[model samples]
Target: MRHLFTIALVSLLLAPPAQAQNDVRFQVLGGDEALRDALIAASRLQAVTDEEDSASQDIVAAARSDYARLLAVLYEQGYFGPDISITLNGREVAGMSPFDRITQVRSAAITVEPGRAFRLGRAVIAPLAPGTDLPEGFRSGAPAGTVILRETTEAGIMGWRTQGHATADVGNQQITARHNEAELDAEITLAPGPVYRFGTLIPRGEERMRTRRVLRIAGLPTGEVYDPDEVDRAADRLRDTGVFTSVGFTEIPNPDGTLDVQAELVEAPLRRVGFGAEIQSQDGLTVSGYWLHRNLFGGAERLRFDAEISDIGAQNSGIDGFVSGLFSRPADLTPDTTLELGFRIEHLDEPTFVEDTASINIGLEHQFSDELTATAGVFARYSDVSDNFSERSVWMVGLPLGLTWDSRDNAFDAASGWYADATLTPFTAFEDGGGVRATADLRAYYGFGEEDSTRLAGRLQLGTVDGGDIAALPPDWLFYSGGSGTVRGQDHQSLGAMQNGVQTGGRSFAGASFEIRQDLFGNFGAVAFYDVGYVSEGAYGEGASDWHSGAGLGLRYDTPIGPIRLDIATPVSGDGTGEDVHLYLGIGQNF
Candidate 1:
């Protein structure tokens, strides 16, 4: 009971402020959900908005300030005609005793009478640009509010500007309220100047990265009709490159009825190095590091090298080491395309296999839009492997195609977003036999409440190998489960197709995970999660297969980089069982 009470208290405190500890009891009487919530949110009823001492005079002063603030809030909610009263200890604040004499404090009451919400009687905006789509509520008999009026005005002006009018303004405005009829009438007009064409790209104040590279990256549609959105997109492109500390675009009128765009850039550091690590109770430890040269080849080219070592524990000496180097040149093809070349080497020692491999891959990735990207590559690899029973050597080449769609607000810690990716690789064996493999993954996040204090996240993954013989396929082409990204409570890569009691890779795989996250305190959070994984020797679940499930709890400490995560879990059901629980420590959300 005590623990339950403590948890309850903490939860209440974490919620966006109604907390007064039974002191200064606050209430709003007689109002709809929207009106009551808005009034409380913008008034002293909220802990953040309460800025006065507990004394009666200070409290009364704060209460008085709420009158205007909440009035404006209601006006935006279409409650143009309102009667609001504030009282302290059941006595009207207007009739309270002098602050010098009144010392006692008790309860506060806010009552709102939003009599007969107002609606638009007539909404007239003249000279609207073609293709203007304003707020849906900007019409006769619709809800009348300040927000609608402001949005309608901005939309009209933006619509004109989008049609090549570089200069657009609100030329006139008239607003009136009919108190007897509970109605409002709004009249506005927009003034749009003549259209203008885009002139040449003018580079300004760019160093280190070169002006031509900046122009190529910006990809502004020069010699086309002037559009503000194009300038914004150009700025976005420059910022996304990470080579610039700051980026901006400015417009200037030319004598030839054209608008010239000037690109401004501030250079960023060219070199950066970073390191991170993760530890798991059952899986041992993993450490990784990377170094990047942002503009090594001068045309926004990037050269990167990274390495990692995993599994440093007593029960096993089969540690794993991996290293890779990659070089990418942006805008080498089209404006939204990048060319990449990479090489990698892996050294592995596991219960089932001890192997080493070296590989190289070359790819071209194109950005179709902000949310979509596609890439195709060719890869070659050679490997030597020795299992507990025998040894084998093989080499292969393959063509890989991949597509991704990302709408997440934050890649590492998302609150309301979705991401999906798919990859297909087809290889022809030089020594053994080859096949085609395909995999796909999807993840989504959703949040609730005003502050998004509660979040739900989910993920699904699937994999298959269609052509290669089971023994001839590259070990890396197969799939396994029971890791941080799969069934967390189980040992890493512990669940797979079994051969003579040895866990080997599988040709088909599926995994699902779900989590519910709750905020506990500032920058602190907790989660309840469930994960399940399935792997089989058959491509379509035809051969031997197994299923595993795990449930867990996690703690998160938010940071600028991402979230520091600590998870503890146990297997609910699985094919392999060796440990009662597993603990994982890492950075970033598990997807």
Candidate 2:
């Protein structure tokens, strides 16, 4: 019974006080508006007093703590000497006992006297590594801001670490304030441990994945000078494979002066499935889905199968579809290289042509960096095509090479940076002889305004089939310049080159699109865009061509995954420019 009584008493003292109203006032007598705001933001009493449930005890506790907190804030702002006081209900809060129980906070007042700001009389950091760039304010005669001292010390330590001093740290700090002269002197010393080399990478928490594969993918340069960046990159590589939900690295120093890094990983589920759909009023609806296996053989190999069906309920084009499968193995030849094998079968039914095609490709992709990659492949294709001009069976073999640079902030709806993809394929067709197909798609985005509320995006697309007979090439290999992808507000495949009074896919194509987007209320945004496309009878815009353009307005509703897009467009220029409007709906930005 006595123990129970003691427990109850302790619980009462520790329990939160009952709800009460508070009126808090904070003033800075010798500071500017910025300093005053900072001090207020740093005050715990000011924060709690704004809450309706703040009790007298809570207010008193917060007020007492505010003394040190406010002083620290002032020092960070170059004020070394400060006086702070807080009063609650006409009583000094600091004088209140911890067990004092009060019913209501009622009112509290805070005052701060910030003395003269201090400038750096002597600022020195010893043994900085070569090429270290410290903060500009960490110099004599500059404001002796406390943050500057921290920045200087951190820079000094980081500089040593970058030079393979894995254990670099701040050894000591000496600070002095001469109150009479309003000056401060700060000295920092760094400890640069012995330079070390990288040992081996140890995998941890990995299930089902091969440990050897993990080490291969990480590509930690064992026996080389230790680099923090390399460790980070190794972790990134594992994450990019999509086999890991989380990846982190820990460093352990060995007696022989080498650092053994451990990769801590959490494996993601092996299988994933996704579906998407898009629609154009004239071209019809398209739906696609994919099934993926992230670790096909416990070696971070990825296998994916995709299928798409299109032209549903279309007014013009016939139904079209494709099925494809891809297999990729990471760390194939080198740590940054990946081997890819793909197979695709496609059927196209357009007003101008109907074709059936099958293709197989083997390729390698090398990552130069996070934003750049290069690919080379060999492919074989078989096609049976029928058009107004001819019906033919064609076989082709090609070497395809590609380079991609992607720095876009977002792939689905980019707000800044640029994306460029260029592909060149040299093929030998049984009917059309040898030829080369080249295409480049470049896009750029710029964002301004607060929180990037306004953005401007642009895209340029160029394609050409050179050194081939236009009539004998696979129909799908040719270019058509009408549809939601080219110029909206026009019928699918409406614009093509004319040969012997028959409209056919062009040998060359060019398209440009520009948009100005503005974020509206909530998750909604508005866009105005213009698109222009040109199709030519010969390669590289060398022959006769026609240009068509469209202008449109769009609306976007943002979601967790991506933005849903709705666009209304009409032909603005060209032979068929008219008031006919077209509508498009999709899950992502048009580009």
Best by lDDT: 2
Q: Residues 93-121, candidate 2: write the lDDT tens digits.
A: 77877766666665678888898999999
Off by over 4 Å in 1: 1-74, 79-116, 314-317, 498-503, 576-579
Q: Per-residue alpha-carbon lDDT of model 1 for 146-253, expressed as tens digits? A: 999999999999999999988788998999889999899999988898788888778777667777898898888888998998888778777877888888778887
Residue 101 lDDT (model 2): 63
lDDT score at residue 540, model 1, on the 0-100 scale: 65
Q: Which 10-residue window of candidate 1 scores lowest in summed lDDT?
A: 15-24
Q: Provide backbone clash counts, one per model.
A: 0, 0
Model 2, backbone clash pairs (residues 3+ apart or across chains), number:
0
For model 2, the run of ten residues with the poorest summed lDDT: 16-25
